[model samples]
Target: MARLADYFIVVGYDHEKPGSGEGLGKIIQRFPQKDWDDTPFPQGIELFCQPGGWQLSRERKQPTFFVVVLTDIDSDRHYCSCLTFYEAEINLQGTKKEEIEGEAKVSGLIQPAEVFAPKSLVLVSRLYYPEIFRACLGLIYTVYVDSLNVSLESLIANLCACLVPAAGGSQKLFSLGAGDRQLIQTPLHDSLPITGTSVALLFQQLGMSFLPFSMSSCRSL
Candidate 1:
């Protein structure tokens, strides 16, 4: 099965730089950012982090979710990204905080307190399935927080396995197993009338010269 997501990214702020722009935050981690005719990485990061620390602001107390759609200039195909932004702060020692705060740059050194920063995890795909990707991210987040050694790339890969697409639809829509067949019974009220073109095509395939007839004509026959 192929992966639902083309790329998975985690973005976080660099507390040292307090101003706006790309330098304010950096891509903490990402899986597979190589060899694309028009990579969505730059635009994706810009959409999420351009204003700087917006995800971590007080307005976003709850988990924030948004979608970004961009057309690949080369292929002229659209790529969508489902992003979830929330607080994912790393605990740091006072000494580490001092180092990260860059005491050398500051006028006078002072004890640093615990830092809280906004982090965003994004999943990019060719299709738009926000609910599916959101659910997948929930599992990925659980695995991420629970295990320190867990690989993000592996997590995304496993997520793709669970969210594989089936004939352009989500796997959740399919209930059949391997070699299994499902009989779909439709009520006449719900069924659509067969068009003359369809009947003509069928007759042509069967090498029959039968002309198309309506239900009323058949009744009279």
Candidate 2:
């Protein structure tokens, strides 16, 4: 069976640190590490993941999301990363950075947002088309933010599953667990058609009345 995504990473800002070094942010969680290829990710990812670090200005809003593309020299495989940035008000009282790292090491769960810093949830894949993932990021994030039923781990799984076609006769679906569950439909293959109505629905899901031409303009492209 073809896999939807190669890696799912949750990167959060480390408030204790001043620079965007290796310790600048913590890799909160990653899925299916055993199946990872020989190439190491997120090693040079700091440069693209958090471009200018966290912003302290309340007047200027930071960009919510962006995409990163790079070629793996060793494997000669092209990779696309869809990073969705978000800021949440997290209450962390006396939670040491070391403790948070320890908890993640032990339970693979992000205990709390590092000192109320912003977070970037990244989805990396070999999918030829990056625009499809970028288009879906907002809707996916909106659903993720609004729903309390989905956890970070499950959200990754759901995102992975969304990249594959729904299970039917002769189609062997990728399984994250023992039982089967419903998944959101997100385009994966290039042949899949996207309609304007679907685009409108995606915008609707994101609570946007109309498309913002400033950020995304056909003329710019």
Candidate 3:
């Protein structure tokens, strides 16, 4: 398993198949996010796969990306201000972080209350560059698969992520198991490679470990 970091990212091509770009318009999808204590919320946030946030800066020229990092306010995972989503204050540019966070209550993007905000933000780009998009989605897939989920939907997403390739047609994918297990892809199996693993193995390996699933905090990937 990868070490927990301040931020984690995974990239992949939403294109249903490898190489060829199809289902491009399905980029915008809603993630069935959850809250602390694991409760489903109806007004789930919307993810803009190709939002302007993809644009990269001079130091990193890739895409214009926005800033959003949602944490479980009730859990210790709340690393920083949960109001960071206020960075979307499109009307104000070059503003102070404190100002934006302070004014978030009335921003209308979310509720004036902190707990009403969505779980996280989704970054997306176009399929014009099929390879690039696939690489991006593949990166996100790695983190999405490895981490434990906070809800059933997240678990389902993790399961589906296994079949998701590095690109639409790319053979690369991630494998998950106990810390003791090794990662090796077997083309004969044509699936995520693991050392004869199973659900029991994962619990056995992860159970004794000091790292709790909540320690992973908010994952941007």
TM-score of each: 0.52, 0.51, 0.20
Task: For residues 18-68, write the lDDT of model 3, one tens digit per residue.
Answer: 343232222233332322233222121233332332221223122233333
Q: Indicate the worst ten consecutive residues by lDDT in candidate 3.
A: 78-87
* lDDT of every predicted structure (CA atoms): 0.50, 0.52, 0.28
Q: What lDDT tens digits, residue by residue, belong to model 1 across residues 88-182?
A: 45444334322335445443344444444567677776655565566666656666656755665666665444444223211243211222222
Off by over 4 Å in 2: 18-23, 38-42, 59-63, 88-116, 161-221
True lDDT of residue 71, candidate 2: 69
**In model 1, what is the error at residue 10, expressed in angstroms?**
1.1
User: Lowest-lDDT window of 10 residues in candidate 2?
Assistant: 166-175
Candidates in descending lDDT order: 2, 1, 3
- Give every collision pair in model 1: none
Report clashes for each candidate as comma-separated counts.
0, 0, 26
Give the TM-score (vs. native) of candidate 2. Answer: 0.51
Better of 2 and 3 by TM-score: 2
Poorly placed runs, candidate 3 (over 4 Å): 1-28, 31-62, 76-134, 138-221
Error of 3 at 211 (Å): 19
Report the number of the highest-TM-score candidate.
1
What TM-score does structure 3 among the candidates reach?
A: 0.20
